[model samples]
Target: MPSALLPIIAWDYQFAPNAQKSRNYLYITHTPFKICEQPFLLPRPALLSLGITYRRVPVLSIGKDVFCDNASFLDAMQELLEREGEGRALKRGGADRAFEAWGYRSFWVALASVPAGLVSKELGEDRRELFRRF
Candidate 1:
């Protein structure tokens, strides 16, 4: 079994959706994982140590395999669940395909239309700076 560590920040509009989705999947499947609430506005050196240069939230660490984005995280989770037989339920509801589309394809496409100025306005200085850099 692999361990997933999710860094959750409750107030982040951009991040909360994916984090909540991941958390829900874990709870429904009864996957044992750790959730740590951290400041999204600050520099996360721990993620950097894991070779995640983007320094974003919703990172899933399975041993040495670190998934940095929602798409990768969900993809890996689906693979793991398939091996555990829980994936059948996901397939039955079309959740497996749905989430993959939402996380990997649709999310970014939708987010692309969101004004960067609006996002910058919502973010604190530290996060705004980091977002610009990334």
Candidate 2:
């Protein structure tokens, strides 16, 4: 009999591509997890019901375990990989990985720093929505 997967969920996250790489790996490895998605800047009443009170985005919860920070979350993932044979190859570590992570972290910051005009006059909703649909 297979081990029953401990209901895994990514709490309230909207990450750019590189962070998505880590997520993509979980999917590729066939790890059992669920996405408890929440809208940005909103109270995650769903996560709160699970005993998480950190008030930060992008957490992981399994059984009684809840991880709040990204570093700790990745470290927990590393532990899971050791048991599951996901290894270092899958993780983009070292300088290149650091750069990509930096890029991922900075993406939203850059987007936010952009003038409001860019969001409206520059990238119209129709054009953005069209890109988003794909």
lDDT by residue for model 1 over 1-134, one digit each (tens)?
A: 33344332221223567677777766776677665554555555665565556655676665556666666766777676687664532554657567667565776567557666666644646565543432
Off by over 4 Å in 2: 1-3, 13-22, 86-93, 117-134
RMSD of each: 5.8, 7.6
Poorly placed runs, candidate 1 (over 4 Å): 1-15, 86-89, 92-124, 127-134
Which 10 successive residues of model 2 have the least lDDT summed?
Answer: 125-134
TM-score of candidate 1 on Cα atoms, chains taken together: 0.58
lDDT (0-100) at residue 29 of candidate 2? 54
Tens digits of per-residue lDDT for model 2 on 28-132?
A: 656667777765443568876766666556676655577765566656666766666545324545786587578767875665565655455443443454334
Compute the lDDT of residue 91 as modeled in candidate 2.
52
User: Which residue pairs show backbone clashes in model 2?
Assistant: none
